[model samples]
Target: MSKHLFSASLLLAISLVVGKSAWGDDNAQSPEPMPPQLEATIKAFEAIGGMHEYRECYGFPSLKFHFFGLKLDSTDADIKKMPVVPFPFAFTSISNSITDLGVAELAKQKNMRALNLVDAQISGQGLAELTHVKDLEVLNLSNSSIQDKGLEALSNFPQLRALRLGNTEVTDDCFVYVSRLKDLEALDLRFTQVQGKKLNELKPCEKLQQLLFSGCPVTDERLQELGKREALEGLDLDYTQVTDNGTKTLENFPNLRNLSLSATKIADQGLEDVGKQKRLQRLYLSGTRVTDEGMSHLGGLDQLEELALSETKVQDAGLAKLSDLKNLNNLKLIRTQVTGTGFDAFSDVPLQTLNLSHAPISDSGMKAIAQIKTLKELTLDHVPLSDEGAKQLASLDNLTLLSLGHSNIGEEGLKSVSQMSKLRVLDLSDTPVSDDSIKELAKLKELRLLYLSGSVITKDSIAQLKKALPNCDIQSDSK
Candidate 1:
């Protein structure tokens, strides 16, 4: 059987074992018997390669179940021989191949609290069948054929807490029904026709916290209506028309913690307003006009943890200003002008992960990075590091994952890399290292994964290295 089918069958067997034990105990209080409608629904779902899991609730025999409708090559006759499931599902996901008949069977699951129908063929009329699921709190119909009339079916789910309609045909007219969901907390309308003009319709949802409008035509004027939502915490405006003026309205959301302005017209002036968000934890400014000057504004965001500055003009001087962000741990400077001169500034920042792929890092920069003792993962793909520069990485005693692909590191560098006894994953693809360096790589007794694609190592050398490190998953061009 295929891997998907094998996994589903194993889970079903385990669930049956647990169910038999629970039901066979006369002294144990068993869950209420399954209704006939639910039994038929489970059988119908199983015919379409569906899998269900049951778990005991609060130390009691009463169990709650989750259903998954996976697309597999199993035939209806094969599924008919499987054992029956005797529990109600609280979560159901019917993606890619669900039909109207399948959805009609799903409506009988009154205990469903979350449903995902992404990329399904069901229409608005099919969605109306789910109105009986009063306890449904989360619904995802992204990449579906659901339109404005189909969204009207959501009026029956006033207690819904989250809804995602990305890449759908729904327009601004759908918000008329969406605005009535007063208990809604999160909404995703990415890549849809619903512009921000009608976003004010969501004012009744005072508990709204997260809103994603990425790949939409949201303008600065329409964005202002969201300024009054002080309860808002996360917002994504990637690929929108909003500029620096649009970001000025962000200060009204004092509780905002995560923000993404990638691929937008936001410039250095916008970072000035973004710096005002003292509680901001994650920020993405990739593909923007932010330069070295804008880095000064981010110094006050002491709570910042993750920041992405890829594909921008940020250089060494820009990184020096971020030295005071002690809480910052993850940073990406891919395709930037950084040469590693300011890496010493992060010595006291406790950074654990850093990516500098495609950057012009020099030998001195590699030497400076060696001082960061807390670094556990590092990437330097497409860098012009010399053999001596690659050797400097040996000082990172805690390094577990390292990538030096497409660099000039030779056999001498691989010798130093072998000294990292704690290294778990190593990538030397597209480098100048040859068969002579295979002995050095074999010394990594703890290495679990190794990649040497596009290297000059011969097939004989790879076979010998594989024999030496039998536990390692070595991937070389010769293989």
Candidate 2:
């Protein structure tokens, strides 16, 4: 009885397989084993294939990969047919692969340029396969099980320019392997085990341009070592363990243009050190120990274009230091205790953009800011500005953007700003401005964006405003 049952089960299985072959599934054969040609295409991506289908192959001068809605380990047959190409194409990207395609196998592809194997089950062996792609320029292996050994595979690529190893197991040992790429330009090591020791390993890439080591455990000394490279353009040291002592290292990199030290333990003294970098264009010091005293250091940076001091201890007293930045353009002071007195600091400066949203600046503060004849963009969200205060913004003859969202400005107050002929963007969302006040804005032919959502403006009033400014976008509550 047992033998008969076994035989019957075996026959049933054979019948199902034969039936599937004869009839086919959806008129197509199930994915079969990878063919030799397709296997070779995977090995030699550049010469045999193009970018992932979604990616524009040949769009850039470097590399390309066609990645379209593909998940890792979707099917082995799909992986074998992946495309590879150089830049100047369209729609190319990198995506996660579930299973590890051993590094040796990846390296076999002589032409593969763009590889997006992020969050794939890549191990040390899989990473090693990447060493063989001598022509690879862009490799994104983010969120993989990569360690120092995995990084070792990258040492073989002499032409690699952009590499993203964010959220990997890279350490000092990994940097040793990374330093070998003499032509490396951009390196993103965010959220990794690399510290100061890694800087020593990165010294080989003297031409390196951008370095993002955010959330690393490195000391200030390591940053100093990396700063020695004059070609370093942008550096993001956010959430690092570096302190004021570490900030001293940054003085070595005089060519840096963009710097982010947010959440670092650096105090006013460290900011003073950073202020000495005359080439600094964009600086971010949010959530740092910087105070009003540090504001003096930043005031002297003539090249500074944009600066952020949100949530810092700096008050109105410190704002006076910034009045000297003649080239200053953009400033953000969100969530700071800066009062109307801080507006005095911009009395002499020609600010183009200012974000004081959530600051306790009323009509009096707006009057002080209006003195900035060149002011183009201004935000007064949640301020105590009434009709009288809202009218004070009319002094800005060249003002193109005025955001009074959630303010006490009503329909009468908006009429005061109607005289701003150059005003292009007006955001009055959540204000008490009614339809009657909006009618006054229709005369401004230069208006581009008009937001009156949540206001008492009726549909007929919105239509009146839209009819007048046919080219403008009127976003009303009714919409």
lDDT of 1 by residue, 1-479 (tens): 11122232233232332212111121223345556666576666566666643332211012222232222232324333433333434443434666555565566666666666777676777778777888777677888778888777887777687788889988877888898899888788889987787877888888877788888899999898775888787788988998999999997789877788988999999999999999898888889999999999999999988899999999999999999999988888999999998997887888888999899999899998899888888888889988889889899989877888887888888878899999877878888888899889999998877888888899999999999999777877674
The list of candidate 1 runs beyond 4 A from truth reads 1-48, 51-95
For each candidate in turn, the TM-score is 0.84, 0.74
Model 1: worst 10 consecutive residues (lDDT sum): 17-26
lDDT tens readout by residue for model 2, 94-152: 43544555334444456665566667667666656565576766666778777777666
Please report, in order, the local distance difference test score of every candidate based on alpha carbons.
0.76, 0.68
RMSD per candidate (Å) reads 8.6, 15.5
Query: Model 2 misses residue 381 by how many Å?
Result: 2.3
